[model samples]
Target: MPVTDIITDEKNLTLTVIADFAHPVSRVWRAYADPRQLERFWGPPTYPATFTEWDHRVGGRALYHMNGPAGEKSYARWDFVEIEPERSFTVDDLFTDEHGDPAPGMPVMRMRFAFEATDQGTRMTTTSDFASLEALQTVLEMGVVEGTRLAMGQIDAVLAGLREWFAGKGTRMEVLTDTLVRVTRAIAAPRSVIWRAQTDPVLIRQWMLGPDGWSMTICEVTTEVGRSSHFGWAPDPGVEGEPFGFDDQLLFLDEPFRIVTAGRMTGVEGPTVTNDLTLTEEDGVTLLTTVMEFPDAATRDMILGTGMVDGMEMSYARLENLLLTRPVV
Candidate 1:
């Protein structure tokens, strides 16, 4: 197991657990920040967990449940009290019922997870603060320590699994809901570098081309919210295809991590669509996920049938190749 120390302080009404991993701080933080990755090892092997709803920001709450071998389930919720990206986060953990309401007569524990760089890699320090000594004793007596130790031991596999899942996989698309779709790709670079390649006008022109016979005729991108950005593409000489473009305005921005945009085709008459993009790094590779929302199921099916994912695969492959030889831009 990666855990190096586990301490209990009755006087302070706290339990501190320290674990070490052979990965960067940012990668470990990403594992926790991403719900898909976090669900892998959040519970014991006999009781795997599944998160139904996850709101990752402060004041947000997450609802999850663990399924036992005998078809039994245990529910829990986390109220995000504070978040500091790669450094730390604090959450109030408590038991909850199916309807997302708190269970009566249960102890709520406030857990702070701190991550810092270490000589080997990263050190994770988790401190659980109890409201009273009785609370601390109650949890200890209920086997929290053993369950946590088993849970922490399983995260290494999750981290390793993530590394294997995305490598060499091209742009992947999935239908998330009746009116929503998600596209994902993993690039062999850091989040900051990927963000720059997607945003910088000069770099965008180099690899934003969707197909072999096309060129970026115009590239205008902005990080400022409410500002419109435009991108246009034209076929090379003797190449076949109509010139196309998209005009979009930033709806929300969280620099280098997430962005939301609303946009429509340049000259086509259609309903505008909303896109939410998120980036997270694991083991030096950045995973880019974009969720697109359409007005209705008809719009969703019509657009997807247009080979949108193929164009995205071509563009993303170009971006990956461009990054390999990129100078400090």
Candidate 2:
């Protein structure tokens, strides 16, 4: 577990927290730089934070809201004053309205984050200065310390996820040309296991769900090179609409390592897309890469506009969890 220490100086109207992460500086730095990663640990676990706007450079601003368990939300904003890459950054933090404008009668704080590399890992120190001791005391009464501690405690899990992604063992997305999108991830499962998960309808149904409340209504896979497969997804219950899915013809197959397919999305106006999937094993981990080529940039952009990147990230995350928890027979 990482160690988090909090210190306060009423006279100086400052609160400081020091913590160490068992990850390299770059890996730890990403928790603050990446908006999606920041959302995972920015607030107490119960009140998850979502950033609607994020810009981390100097003079940039961020607008976010923390959603409480009881359908409540607290909006906030940050004005970045300075940023030093993987080293340090300073920001002005303040309470904001739902529209991201600063809230009246709210105390503002200047916060600084410093990161240093150590033999064990990266050490991070955060200091927040209030305009007056009263402001500091007020926030303390609001359980700031404990809430912050709980939030920071989640960094370890984020660091682990980032390590896999950044260490060449996690998913990477690239846009090759205007019509192609490539995604790759490294899994800590055997090639055979991963191959089965891709081709076996039973296993596919477990990891192929689009998002929460979405389920696969149909899944069929044929390992033969000339055969075809089909999969479909239905939205959450009570939704009024037909399910959407895809039908694909397997063009190539290389046992447990490679597969190529040409598929068309059902109930959607789009050109047929070609999918190329490859798997490689190194040590005990297997790396999976997927390439999707569309007929035109317009089609690709239309799909990208539908939060495809975030959806894919969530889907891959669920797959990773499944691989870790499900017993492989």
TM-scores for the candidates: 0.57, 0.52
Candidate 1, which segments miss by more than 4 Å at Cα? 1-161, 327-329
Cα error of candidate 2 at position 89, Å: 0.4
Quality of model 1 by C-alpha lDDT: 0.84
Worst 10 residues of 1 by lDDT: 154-163
Error of 2 at 280 (Å): 25
- lDDT tens digits, residue span 1-329, model 2: 36468999998899999999889999988889999888867876445688999987898999999865334689999999999999999999999999989998888999999999999999999999999888899889988987786677656646775334446434566675576676767777788988888888888888878667788888988887667898888887776556788888887776776687888886666577777776656556776767777889998888778776676666777877998887564
Give residue 206's lDDT in candidate 2 (0 to 100). Answer: 84
Model 1: per-residue lDDT, tens digit, 36-84? Answer: 7897668754455789999999999999998653346789999999999
What's the lDDT for residue 92 in model 2? 96
Q: For model 1, what is the error of residue 255's alpha carbon versus the real structure, in angstroms, after optimal superposition?
A: 1.0
Any runs in candidate 2 off by more than 4 Å, and if so which? 162-329
